[model samples]
Every structure is written in C-alpha cells, then in structure tokens.
Target: MDDDENLPRKTNDPLAALVKQDLDPLSVDELDERISALKSEINRCEAKKSFAVSHRASAENLFKK
Candidate 1:
C-alpha cells in the first residue's frame, strides 16, 4: 500500500486545500496573482486585529472610569 493512502484526505477547509496546492503547474503570472491576493488578505486581517485591540482598550477604559 502507498504511504500516502494512510494519510488523511483533504478537508473542507479552503485554506488547507490552498496550502496543499501543487504550485509547480502554475504559471509565473498565476503565482504573482496568488501572492498579491495573499498580501491583500494579510492586510485585511491586520486591520481587523488592530480594530479589535483598540475596541477592547476603549471598552476597558470606559469601565475603569
């Protein structure tokens, strides 16, 4: 039996599938596009995190007053 057969199959998670994607078949342009999209996602996540942190601090200050 193949060793890979013992491994778990792909999950329903898009991020997990993306991480396991075969990049060798992709063209340079496709790779560039992927990188750009990933950067945009990173920026979005960072903005959300910043907002959450500031919002929590504001809430804490309000209760302390």
Candidate 2:
C-alpha cells in the first residue's frame, strides 16, 4: 500500500551500519597545529590591514582617539 515496502536493503548500507571503531578526541598536537596555522593567517591579515591603514592615514585619522 506504501512506497516504504519497495526499498531494497544491503548489509553495507551506510544508514544501517554501526561504527566499529572507538571514537577519540582530537590530540593536543593536532589542536596546536590548527591553532598555529590560524594565528599565522590572522597575523598576515593584520599586517596587510596595518599597511593599508598607514597608507590611508587621512581617512583613518577620523577614527583615531
């Protein structure tokens, strides 16, 4: 009477499979590596903005304390 009865199932179906591997938290080394990469990216953007601000001193002076 319904489309639900028409589906074919497999032993390897992703939705039906149970994960056998033990789940583990990310290691501190991995976390630190990601943090260091992010820091470098942030520093690069800050340096670029600093250079642009210095070049546009007249426009930037409006916000100076």
Candidate 3:
C-alpha cells in the first residue's frame, strides 16, 4: 500500500470548505441554512442555561426555608 493510503483522512469542515473554494461561491440559501442551524444551536444552549439557573434558584430557596 502507498504511504498516502496509510495517512489518516481529515474531517470535513463545511465552513472552511466553503471559504477555501473560490470557483463555486456559497449561495444566499446556503448562508440562510447556516444561520438557521446556528440559531437552533443557540436556542439549545440558552435552554440549558435557563434550566441550570432555575435549578439553582430552587436549591437556594430550599436552603433558605
């Protein structure tokens, strides 16, 4: 087998791939999709933060009682 074949493959970076390629530019729709995906991820993180805050509040109230 060739040394090239023995080398591990790099994981695909969609953003970097888009940035690297000059021949085919990213479309508006593709940008929107990326934005939507980021928004969803943000919402998920926010939900987790809110849950942690509420849980902390509940624990504090219990301690005070």
Greater lDDT among 1 and 3 belongs to: 1
Q: How big is the RMSD of model 2?
A: 16.3
**Candidate 1 residue lDDT tens string, 1-65:** 89977877667868779888999999999999999999999999999999999999999999999
Best by lDDT: 1
Best candidate, TM-score: 1
Models, CA RMSD each: 7.8, 16.3, 10.7
Tell me the whole-model lDDT of each prediction, alpha carbons only: 0.93, 0.71, 0.79
Clashes of each: 0, 0, 0
TM-score of each: 0.78, 0.47, 0.58
> In model 3, where do residues sit more than 4 Å from their true spots?
1-24
Residue lDDT tens for model 3, 2-41? 8876765565956457446563465989778877987898
